[model samples]
Target: MASVTENKPSNPWQVWRPGIDPAADALERVSVLINRHEHITAGYAFTLGESARRYAEQCSLGFLLGLEMVVREHGNQAAILGWRHAASTVPQPSKSQNEGEKDA
Candidate 1:
C-alpha cells in the first residue's frame, strides 16, 4: 500500500506566519509579480507595497496576500513550496496520509 505522507504543524498558518521570516519570501514573490506585469501601475505598487508594509502590522493578512500574489503570479506549486519554506522555521508535527485524511 502506498501510504500518504502529510506535514502538519501544531500551530495554525497564522502562527506559522509570524515566526517565519518574510524578506526572502517577499522578494521571491515580488520578483515574480514584477516579471508578470510589464507595465507597473500605481495600484500594482500599492498592492505589493501594502502587502509588505502590512506584514509587520498585520501578519496574517500580509502572509495571505503574499501567498495569494505568488499563487496568482506563479502557480499553486510555487505557493505550496513557499508555504513549506515559510513553515520550515517552526517545528512541525508529522502525520501519515491516512491520519491527515481522517482529520480532513
Candidate 2:
C-alpha cells in the first residue's frame, strides 16, 4: 500500500528532512538575518532559501562571531556566503548595562 507521502512529487529545491535538521535550521536563520538588513553586511551560510527557525537582529561583532561559528559547525554541504560593510551604527547599551558602567 503506498502512503500519502509516497505519492507526493518531490521538488528538487526542497530538501527531504527526516525530522529536524539543526544545521539547515541554523543556516537559514543566519541567512535571513543577513538578508533582512539592507545595510547589514555579515557572513551567512544557507542550505535553502529560508530558515527552519528564525532570524534575529543584533550587534555586528557579536553577529559576526555567531555567524562564523554556525558556518564552521554546519558548513558541510552548505553554500558559504560572506560580506562586510562597516556602515551599521552600533546599538547603545541598555539601561541595565549602562547602570553597571556608572558603578565603575
Candidate 3:
C-alpha cells in the first residue's frame, strides 16, 4: 500500500480568490510592485502591497474591491490576516510606531 500525505489548507485570504489565469496576472503585477519598491521598509508595506496585488490579479477586481469594502465595513480582522502573511515569516509589530514611543 502506498502512503499518502494530506494537503494542508491554504490561507483564507488566498482561498478567498478564485480562478487561475487572473490569479497569475495578479501575481505578476505584485512582482512588479515589489521590484519597484524593493528599497522601502522590508516589512509590512511591501508585504501588503504584494498580497493585495496578487488578490487583485488572481481574482476579479470587483471581488478584490468588494473584499476591501467588506474589510472596511466589517473591521480589519480579515485584512489583518492577509497582511500578516505578506509581511514576513517573522511577525511585524502590530502597532504603528509613534514619535513618543521610546525604544526598549
TM-score, cand. 1: 0.27
TM-score of each prediction: 0.27, 0.25, 0.27
What clash count goes with each model? 0, 0, 2
Query: Candidate 3: lDDT of 35?
Result: 57
State in Å the error of residue 60, model 2. 23
Span of 10 residues, lowest total lDDT, candidate 2: 81-90
What value does the lDDT take at residue 30 in candidate 3? 44
Which residue runs does candidate 3 get wrong by more than 4 Å? 4-42, 70-104
Write model 1 residue lDDT over 7-67, tens digit each, in one string.
4445443344533676544554455455654555545544554443333233466666655
lDDT over C-alpha atoms for residue 87 of model 2: 18
Q: Supply the global lDDT for candidate 2.
A: 0.43
Model 1 stretches with alpha carbons more than 4 Å out: 3-19, 39-41, 53-104
Predicted structure 3: lDDT: 0.48
lDDT of each: 0.49, 0.43, 0.48
- 76, model 1: CA deviation in Å? 25
TM-score: the better of candidates 2 and 3: 3
Candidate 2 regions off by >4 Å? 1-19, 39-66, 69-104
Candidate 2: C-alpha RMSD after superposition: 10.3
